[model samples]
Target: MNILFVLLPLGLVLLAIAVIAFFWAVGNGQYDDLDSPAWRILLDDESKPPKDPKDSP
Candidate 1:
């Protein structure tokens, strides 16, 4: 029974911290782009090959 007093407040404090962190993340645009990153990973880069040094004038 004595442990309840400690555990209850501890649980509430942890819940409050989690709520604050979630709000902070939303305010900072953390979840603004939902789909672009996934699609970007599927896209390929337009890469160019390096030329040999002997080809230079």
Candidate 2:
């Protein structure tokens, strides 16, 4: 009974924060190019070989 009052407001506050964060992300282009990053992980950077410190000048 008493716990409900505390839990309900706490849950609502968390929900409000989540919604605000989602909208903020959308406005900041956070969701743009969602697929490219996933594909990028599978793609290899073959243009250059891994540099060795001993070989570096």
Candidate 3:
């Protein structure tokens, strides 16, 4: 019975911390570009050309 008082407040504090963290992430632009990162992996990087072994000193 005594443990309920301790556990209840601890649980509420944890929940409050989680809610604050979620809002902080949202305000920091964490979820702004969700799709671009996934699509980036599929796109080929053509900016740099492959170097040949003969070109090395």
Q: How high is the CA lDDT of each candidate model?
A: 0.95, 0.92, 0.94
Better of 1 and 2 by lDDT: 1
TM-score of each: 0.84, 0.75, 0.79
| Deviation from native of the Cα of residue 14 in model 3, angstroms | 0.4
Candidate 1 regions with alpha-carbon error over 4 angstroms = 53-57
Please, what are the lDDT tens digits per residue for candidate 2 over residues 1-57? 999999999999999999999999999999988999889999978766449867755
Model 3, range 1-57, lDDT digits (tens) per residue?
999999999999999999999999999999999999999999999865449867666
TM-score: which candidate is best?
1
In candidate 3, stretches whose alpha carbon ends up further than 4 angstroms from where it belongs are 50-52, 55-57
Task: Return the top candidate by lDDT.
Answer: 1
The C-alpha local distance difference test score for the whole of candidate 2 amounts to 0.92
What clash count goes with each model? 0, 0, 0
Q: What is the lDDT of residue 51 in candidate 3?
A: 95
- Per-residue lDDT, model 3, residue 38, is 100
Which digits, one per residue and each the tens of the lDDT, describe model 1 over residues 1-57?
Answer: 999999999999999999999999999999999999999999999966659877665
